[model samples]
Target: MAKIVVLGAGLGGVIAAFEIRKSVRPEDDVTVINENAFYQFVPSNPWVLVGWRDREDIIVDLIKPMKKRHIELVVGKAERVEPDQKRVRLTDGREIGYDYLVIATGPELAFNEIEGLGPKGFTQSVCHIDHAVQAHTAFEAFCQDPGPVIVGAVQGASCFGPAYETLMIIETELRRRRIRDRVPMTYVTSEPYIGHLGLDGVGDTKSLLESELRERHIKWITNARVIRAAPGMMTVEELAEDGSVKQLHELPMKFSMMLPAFRGVDAVRDIEGLSNPRGFILTDKHQRNPKFPEIFGIGVCIAIPPIGKTPVPVGVPKTGFMIESMVTATAENLGQILRGEAPSHEATWNAICLADFGDKGVAFVAQPQIPPRNVNWSGSGGWVHTAKVGFEKYFIGKVKAGKSETFYENAVLGLIKTKKIKAH
Candidate 1:
């Protein structure tokens, strides 16, 4: 019997385990390894920072669900990956052998790359639930003494949506509290433009976001590099098209949230031929590692180059829908291999994102997440905000129910003509 091991219990890993179990033979052993036994809905983190959600609202216990599926659950941090031996070594000195391995450890927040950044430093973060909780505590203190607010993504950061959403959500909250006028909000981003989002401004997103910020009286500095952050202050260097620093600003703030750059986790970083320079798993189009075919990578752990060159580094985002497609493709291909057939399936890598701003929001659909695609559409309204809330409830329920892909979910994707897995 083949033993399939899925690492990390984030969105991708959890869904992958369920999907793989559905596709693999019953005799095959399926196991999921995670540092914690609970799954946190990462997308709701921004809401948590603004006091819209609590810890219990987004955290899901995986013990009962995994047990129902008969999937082995190991709670421990991964220390090393031995691809040659087809085994993963846990931090506690235990090894789990696997016929196939799926790495979904997600990105390691590179906060140390910048001086005085991250929760341990001066700035706050909403990347994780714990960070969001910390940020919320800081926000409470900030509200008592309102000052300038700085929010955006640092250089080399790929996930820009959360940064944008957090900024707007904070604005919405402050306005609701009648304290927005006291807080001078400033958006500093590594993106070349306001809405580049590393995909180069999907469907006039530049115009839509620019107008929205302007309407809300939010100022912005694009092509920005955050050199350092200090208590109640941050230093930003705005870059020109020629890659030179056009100007530097010492912005003062009582609250700040800057998304940090991402790299592969420590367990896989030093593994040669398995990861890129940043430690992200290097996979072919089929989500299979070129050097180690038995290994697959999905979500933020996979290496995806920047969409195009910019004045500052901006990595591409691996959105929820795109990662879901990868999970489907990986399951299909692995199932084919088990059935004595050639593995042949590819994920569409389509991106369907909902970026809520508390009251109103933006929704975008890219047929292919990368630029130069077939369909690139973006729209904004209160409906998006409602839809986002509904989506959160639906997704969390699905995870609780141990259902990876539902007929309604598949039917919706089918209606959009975007198959989860397609022929390569």
Candidate 2:
């Protein structure tokens, strides 16, 4: 029986551990190590910042569920990964050996890259629960004295959905409180267009997003690179039509939140041949490290290059569905390994995004996420919100129950069954 070690305990990590549990033999051991006892629903962090959800509502104890799944759980931060030794060193100086390792630590938020843009300043982020709490306090203060607001992801940033989600939720909350008119909001993004979304503009997304922003009176500045940020002001450079010289603009704001470029976690950063310079691990089509077949990575931590270059900097986005597909493929391959067989499969990027637009929302599904793709489609409606909420509930329940594969299979089978029924 093989021993498997998974790191992080985030959505990706927990999902991998649970899937391993479902597939590996009883004698095999699967262990998860994380610094925190509870798993944070990262997507709902925006709601926490907007006061739509509380800190407690998004935090769940991972111990009980992990125990039920018969997986060992270690609550400690990983210090280093000695890949050659097949061991992981903990912050407390303990080391554990494993036959297989899965890196799912997710991306590191590089707030320090931008001057005066972290918790030390007046600006706040919704990247983590703590950040969300601080943002909530900042938003409350803004309510007392409404002013200009800046919200968007920084240059080289990939995760644009959260930035957009946070902006709209803030607008929705401000409108609900009757203070929206008192606040001036602007979206500053590195994308060449407003809706590049790291996939080179998903199917008319640019047009739809531009129209939505105009209709909502939310000003946007694209192809702009943020140089630095202070409490109430930010310096940005607007790309010229020729993309040669940059024209600078200084914008003032009372509140701001910007998603920074992502990098891999510190523990695995220094390991030779283990990660890219940006700290993301390099994995094969099967999600296994090229040098070590037993080692794998998934989610934002894996190094996948940007789709294309735009006037403004944009990194590829690993959306929910995309992340889910990675997890599914990884789990299936690991299962095959446990069964003494070769893994033969590849997972493609199929994005299904539900972008909330205040009271209503926009939904889109683009298979092979990049532009000029097959089966690109979208629709706008209020029911998308309900569907999003339902998906959130379903996702949280799956994590809590430690039924990763079962949940995923049921979801896919249901989709297929629905398609068959419609055909009939």
- Point to the candidate with the largest lDDT: 1
Q: How would you encode candidate 2's per-residue C-alpha lDDT over 328-397 as one tens digit per residue?
A: 7887788888888998756676777777755776666667776676756555667656666766688788
What TM-score should be assigned to candidate 1? 0.96
Clashes of 2: 0
Cα-based lDDT at residue 115, candidate 2: 82
Candidate 1 per-residue lDDT over residues 209-252, each given as its tens digit = 99989999999999999999998899999999999999999999
- Shift in Å, residue 97, candidate 2: 1.0
RMSD to native for every prediction?
A: 2.9, 2.5
**Worst 10-residue stretch by lDDT in candidate 2?**
415-424
Give the Cα error of residue 248 in candidate 2, in Å. 1.3
Per model, how many backbone clashes are there? 0, 0
lDDT of 1: 0.91
Clashing pairs in 2: none
